[model samples]
Target chain A: MTRLSSAQRHLVRFTLNGKPVQGEAEPRLLLTDFLRQTIGATGTHVGCEHGVCGACTITVDGELARACLTLAVQIDGCELRTVEGLAPAPDRLGVLQAAFRRNHALQCGFCTAGILMSLDHYLRAHPKPSEAEIRDLLSGHLCRCTGYTPIVQAALEAAAELAELSRSDHRDV
Target chain B: MKPAAFDYVRAETLGEAIEVLAQHGGDARIIAGGQSLMAMLNMRLARPKVLIDIMRLRELDRIDSTSGSVKIGAGVRQAALLAWPELATSLPLLSKALPWTGHAQTRSRGTVCGSLAHADPSAELPLALVALGGELHLRSAGKQRKVAAREFFAGMMATARADDELIEAVSFPSGNARCAFREVARRHGDFAIVACAAVATKDGVRFAVGGVADVPTARDWPRLEGSALDDALNGFAHELDARDDVHATARYRRDLVRLIGRDLVREVLQ
Candidate 1:
């Protein structure tokens, strides 16, 4: 059998953080590599390339996925969200980010981005998650520092803040 | 580690996918969710000349429920099955077992049929399929066949699926049986050291044990009360010949199978 040359590349177009993005990559290029190198979205870290660690977790088409395990070409027409997309503005952090900071959820900050991204998507579906449910979500992630106490606290606070913001928006309308 | 270079072809239909698989034969591998295949490829554990991406075959992504059975397509993601409300009622054992297969992110892209086809002995899907008395539908270019879950899984990471055959769907018998799933793992989403799935019917109970044998094993038990059931469970556990692994000793696994088996059986019976 003939082997495909590593130099062979394919053109891929997708929506990244609500903006159209296009790049050239090999069919074997992982989404984590494409995001970090091609599109320059380095917030999605590659901890364990085998998908055991959740550091490369991102949202593909609004669903949480491990970028390291997903092929770049497979998400050709999908919308993707990385940790860079989580901030509401350049000057200020997003609600979850602010809560993370307030709760001191980071020590080394390596696993923070992926944890934030996972919780960002999780809290959307479960705005009022119980403590048990929060722990269950955190089970997908691995954090060596902070012992997860602060991270869980931050998630709970963010959920409350997000819920409060939605309530206020409804009141104003 | 990065995966070795491989050509990719996205098939627009099931027929096209089958034709490509036949043409490439052993050189090509079908990829649905890429949850398991990608990991293998990255580790250089598997390297094929071509990857036949079948995610575009939307025709193989439906979930159909008919009188006492539910057919889940090969492309149906694990998370989709978990979220499907009908599954809770139709296949209660599967619903209880899916969450333990992997975390939310992995389940979001992992396919139910892919997990079964991968045939990992410690995987929750195969154990649940065996306990539920499921049948897998395998299709080639012009021929198709159904294999029982018990017979389909030959051993760890092995199945009866031929090189040219694709798993089109898996049909599971649905019933009003009470069910329970229990597994002891290092973490919540990790592979189980010993996993047991039990489905209790009015007549008796069907018990399946994973991570303790070459392949997941299922047995039907008649209604036996008190010491009779305990003695039977002990004998069944001893028959497994559970092997020592990095995670556990053979004796530990046997003990877990006995203890967890009785607990799960009792839970389902209740």
Candidate 2:
């Protein structure tokens, strides 16, 4: 068993959005703070630290999780993905982001990063997700803006686009 | 809110975790999935001097389905149980209620044993466990014991488990009993305002209610129909002592008990 002192900062190393990253964190340091403060990746927002708000949603080892609920030391050596990893390039928005833009899914955009991360992970597994499924998946998040109708539309559209892209890639292969 | 400073230990084995718990007792807390515990830590509801990480204990991460019961280990996440191939066939009630436990994101990280450990009055897992008449396997450094689901849950956010004991696993009996689960929440994946689970027995159905009382409560009844069922549900609802919270009124909760309780009992019995 590996033990770290609560009072001292420990070296935490993990793969961040496919890149190896290391930071120092005390035992009480939440993954949300570690990502935004230590690693300097502010894409993963921290709204409600108590896990009720889905603003801090990210993926640990490719599984969707709330960053606020996760301790930084716990994710050691795990592959972590946040909203910053969504886009393929600096200038290009990913398919899901583009869909959100087209559908006007986000208004204030506070909840967008977490929503995008969730949709990105969910759509990959459920490429043929129905409207109800999208809404169900989205229940984790709370958005005061856009009334969720546009967000649902964007998720469905993104799923279709992702499915179509995969089919075409198969054809090309 | 941020958690108070505490030492962290990533336990490589169950034995190591037990040792740590033995040393610190109430001063140490077990972290498995850390869904509920982390939330408490953030809110400073629970402040342990040391946090033991048992997620890495691969031996504890198992879903062993025997012919009689489905035993879920401490490391079994809510998502893993939901994804289990035999879950629907073995524990239909869990399959129905697991989706309502939490959102997909939280479910992916929340452990089944952890939920039972938290023992939230309105939580689905504890209700399902009680309704199914499951057994919780608890172990300490020196001794191990099995506690019945009905006896395990003492009260709201409370269990009979000792601080030195870690819930090793929980076993739910596998049967062909028709089961039904219904919940009324502010939103999907939210904590249930009133959750009910009914399981058909030989002579009658076992009805369980959550969110209406301090702990998930169950009542066994002979098969009844129409007004008889309604009267029984009403009596049970009153017995729960539903409280008025920000999400709902006590009367509204009792009403749900009568309405949703009737629906679930009938669905399972039929």
Candidate 3:
């Protein structure tokens, strides 16, 4: 078709946490809209409606992707992890989250979810990134409150905690 | 806030994607990461009637170094390029320019082919690729052709991509050469207002400046040293046709062209 076509595409089925969920959406429907409106997973917030804001961030098949900029139809068989799915099970406040809370990393809580999600991945990839590296990585995210000191501290503390845990595990070995 | 409705086709293979493009024609858009495409789609700036999702194209997602050149698949993500080892040793300029991309999260999904295809005049990768003398492999339904980096970039947001054609890969020649890049932008991760990539080869010095002119302008000066080099650079700086944009003025960009060009060539080459 010369003009854009709207089709009632097949239901998109995917896993949230360990459960399978299905929903119907058009090719143009955004994954953020699908998550918020369909499943009511409001933890993934929408800020810029573009990829600029980290608020609508989520983990698709373990990789961080902006839900706001992704199409719902694209996630047919992928596994998604949202903030709601993250909690004490991975250890209370999840290390990064707990560190943020302990260090008072958030204030207004608007950009926290996105940063938390992104930091989750960043910390996993780089357990102990330097103060400069933390700042460099966090440069991808926006934090309006805490002036980034506390957040950066939280990330720093999380790295230390992760290092300790790694040492403990190695000692156990 | 939502993108316009479009016909979605998840191509199972590269041939299918090309066929779909041939049938659907110009209104069809191929999306890899959708990092750049989705933004334009949402703003209604790009309302492609047919959206071809090429995320599953396995062939276009490879990065391999063969012979002396590095063959980066069109779908090779930006993060992949940053992680590639040869590009670092063979072309250090590409490595240095990697951080100037959008961000880590965006780089995780953004593809090299898409960036070259989008051909933003001021972007780092394109300028680096041009300076390195990369060859873009463009594939159509029945034919595939390679265009040199010098001829690939037409202008701002413009490239040599043709209708019913897709970028197969981009290959840059390998050499024992030194390279450097300098770009001044509004913010750290923001697009460049003016960027230049300079290559110091055994032959001579090549200077390519983007975000200052319509298309990338390259100049190869006769090897000069001392005051002669400074005088030539000053003359070239005064002769550029820079434009005024929201980020910078024509005058500021022109001066940057001279300063950065001189800085990179003199420091890296000399």
Candidate 4:
């Protein structure tokens, strides 16, 4: 292995949530670490660092990506959205998060954030997904506590809520 | 787990990337999506002295179709390829196989060329590439060459690519062939114990199996119906002599191969 000095840090600038954020990171620093440590977006949890678990999932440039597998430098100019960005207000939960809570989707809550992020991205593209489609989307995420039934229920409810919101937005337009 | 300390260079263009690869020799590893490489690095399975970040090589991130053939550049992510509107009509086999490659998040960051280069025996991309009979374009500092997919994979986690050569693009011939991909994994997104891809064209049918051997192997079969195709696949499965591991016994894998092969062939024929 080639040893770089501990002082080595590269500057990365990217849009976090709706704000532009910049930080110094090692080239090998993962995007998960960058979000959690440097920018203090700790809502993006890290379970399996090798990209198996979806705990470190986030959206980069409107696409769902595994933060554990992405380098901080790779998203220099990209827009990123972590779990923290899910809520419309600082204190209130987003539609997906509220549906997850209402449906008892989380037991341990460790996997909830990742699931929320993934479902948020999926539901954006598929506003009214079926239960089977929700289950297929959740297959990417590993949830040990919820037995996946409640999580799937949460996703289905969230999809319904999102579809309603889209319809209302269109009506308002 | 974190990756070991290494020098990182973001190559701007293909020529520059090839120069860096040539300069570093075997000490460097090229990273596009970094899905597989990051996992290997975190596990200490790969210890490269230099990481050539080819993610910025936008010139290679194109999917071009010309004369009934599609050329996908190395930097093209799996999800991007899947999202391509023309992919379903141009390369139906790849379109059918991409969803099984990984989850949405991983596919968003994993590149098609990266999967081909990683060369895991259980990986779906290589199996699909072989089944589709794709061609890999490799480039060095001063030379470029195209290799057939059948000859690209050497063994488990090994390929015919030279240390200095960079996979520039992969090309697949376009045809309206009926294709099907089937795999038996422990879970929805997990690696398959045995996977098969079958494509039936007017000429003949081609079948490739993964996770049963060191590398995905493909065989051409004549158009046969019913029990004849099943018997041929059964014979082919026995000839594979797949290895045994913690996940499954060699016999189980062979059986899976035969079953999946038959199913896929039937789907293609229909």
**Candidate number achieving the greatest TM-score relative to the actual structure:** 2
Q: Highest DockQ among the candidates is held by which one?
A: 2
Cα error of candidate 4 at position A64, Å: 0.9
Off by over 4 Å in 1: A1-7, A170-173, B201-203
For A138-167, candidate 4 gives per-residue lDDT tens digits of: 888999898999888888887777778777
Which residue pairs show backbone clashes in model 2? none
- Candidates 2 and 4 compared by TM-score, better number: 2
Clash totals in order: 0, 0, 0, 0
Per-residue alpha-carbon lDDT of candidate 2 for residues B130-188, written as tens digits (9 for 90 to 100): 99899999999989999999999998899999999999999999975599999999999
Clashes of 4: 0
Q: Which 10-residue window of candidate 3 chain B scores lowest in summed lDDT? A: B234-243
The model with the greater DockQ, 2 or 4, is 2
State each model's CA lDDT, in order.
0.88, 0.92, 0.80, 0.86
TM-score of the A-chain for all models: 0.93, 0.97, 0.87, 0.92
* DockQ in order: 0.51, 0.93, 0.45, 0.49
Tens digits of per-residue lDDT, candidate 3, B29-121, equal: 889988888888888888988898887888888987767788888778898788876767866777878888877878888888888888877
Docking class of 3: acceptable
B99-172, model 1: which lDDT tens digit per residue?
89989879999999999988888999999889888899999899999999988999889999998889999999
Report the error of model 1 at residue A81, Å: 0.5
Compose the digit string of candidate 4's lDDT tens values, residues B157-237. 999999999999999888656888888888877888988899886667899998887889988887877899888988888
Better of 1 and 4 by lDDT: 1
Candidates in order, interface RMSD in Å: 4.1, 0.5, 4.0, 4.4
